[model samples]
Target: MHSIGLIGGTFDRFHAGHHSLLLAGLEKCQKLEVWMTSDRLVQAKDSRILSWDERAAELLNFIGEDLSSSLSINSLEDNVGPAPTHSEAGAIICTSETRANCEEINLQRQKNGLGVLEIIQAEYVEAHDGKPISSSRIRAGEIDSEGNSWIPKNSRQGVITLTKEIESKLKDPFGILCEGPEDDLSVAILGALEVAGDGASPIIGVGDVTILGLQLVGINADIGLIDEKTQRQKWHGYDDINQSNFDNILNCINPPGKLTPSLLDACEIAMVNYHNDESTLIIVDGEEDLAPLFLHPLAPIGSVVLYGQPHRGVVLRLTGIDSKTRCRRLLNAFSSE
Candidate 1:
């Protein structure tokens, strides 16, 4: 008989205690087979159950790259069999909380003409506050409140990594447009609204023309308008232009910088500027030309187009390209209020 150990769970949140149990089981058995509960079974058992596909994905993510090489996961309850039994497995590993189900599983295996197998039970892990570490507890938003260290260092890092991957997948890289210093903001605004719609967010960097363009569309976003004269006068001791007419004062208050450079130079900036703040649309307007600006030291890796709009108002010209056609198809998925 193969030394296969079966582990089952809804794995809604895939916490650290679950990971520790899997590691311990794997060490005792030659091969580890993770039986993720089906969505229907999970819904029937737990109040806040994740979908089968999502549960599997979370399990795979939690296992990480190294351990995944030695383990396999499946939603067996939703598969051909009517829930997996210990007869098919060398041993079944369960937490003390679920140990009572072991007898029921064994009986079902016997009825199916398979002999009973060993049942391995692991002790429940305690949180910092003396409460049991559980998915339900974490999902209820009581982990931090109860002072429960539910998120281990590795699991916390894994969650961040998974979140970033999901965010990147959702973002449309081609939707971004890089406008040069000489390029008119009016033209860019028209182009962006034409291409991405009025919902697009425009991030105006240090420039006079770009800020004017943003105001024309009634779009208010952060503008990184630096008071060059005042800054020079105060810092460099050269008082030329009046403080009121300084370039920064004339431009928008927040002078937006290149997303790529800002992301690469500072960790906090990168996480805040580029990560999915889906509510706010981002358009970068900088001093450098569009093509070269996109070629900045920290530009994101993807193919982007630089174009100019001759007209003032938004132009919705349909491109014959297949990608653009797909984009239109995707746009139709969203319903306008």
Candidate 2:
């Protein structure tokens, strides 16, 4: 009987390491069946590298029509159930990290009266720096000098393009000045709203910019609004509040006590009452307010705030404070800009 091999993954973009593994598996098995994860499963796995259609198309392109004719490519995860199992193939090819999962698969096969499965473990390719190269690592922008060499020439350009795009989107406008601990929320909201207002341009600040960029993409926005008042309202009432007194006064005034006591209780008192006397006019503008709020203790008022405006734009802002000084510093920075 001819032996068949089964391989599965998101395969967002087929790389040389993947090509080598498939070829190695085909050499050992008479035929190879490639199972692509379903779109839903891909999302569940947090494999946002690409859309399901894009991933499938790329895989088909990589395998080509000739080899793909013999290779079965289907989204088993979508057809079957959650965490779908593979059929009783002759063997399954997987990486060392997923070896345990392969074992579990074989055990399931055994229970189903299918004989033991042959497991093919592919050796991990390392970059020049001896660091293991993986799709996740590459996606995370960790491609070092050694890792770049191991990448296939054909795929390198695409990877570079993707990396550049992500980097561009993640750039911070305020440069390294946005790195201050207290300025995180202000920086994130400002950056996101700016992108939503603009045409997906890059900014410079810190990781907050990247976080806001991701949020904007979810809303399909090009730019966002900034509502300093609304942002302040939300933060003043939240617990573990640690912002400047000036920010607190701004939050209290802009939304004009729009904050709920429960929220304030959750955020603690210092953030709400710190700067009761400061004169600050909260600015309300942008579309970032449409996005869902990621609640957290001492979280910047508008740190996770987003507003989506159809055919217009999104707005975001910052509110609340742990200290009056920090809030003033952030506002000063904004004014200076």
> Candidate 1 residues 32-66, lDDT tens each?
78878777676666544568887788778878888
- How does model 2 fare in lDDT? 0.43
- Could you give me the TM-score of model 1 versus the true structure? 0.41
Candidate 2 per-residue C-alpha lDDT over 152-174 given as tens digits, one digit per residue, 9 for 90 to 100: 23321221112333334323321
**Candidate 1: residue 170 Cα off by (Å):** 25
Give the distance in Å from residue 307's predicted Cα in candidate 1 to where it truly belongs: 40
In candidate 2, where is summed lDDT lowest over 10 consecutive residues? 287-296
Backbone clash count for every predicted candidate, in the order shown: 8, 60
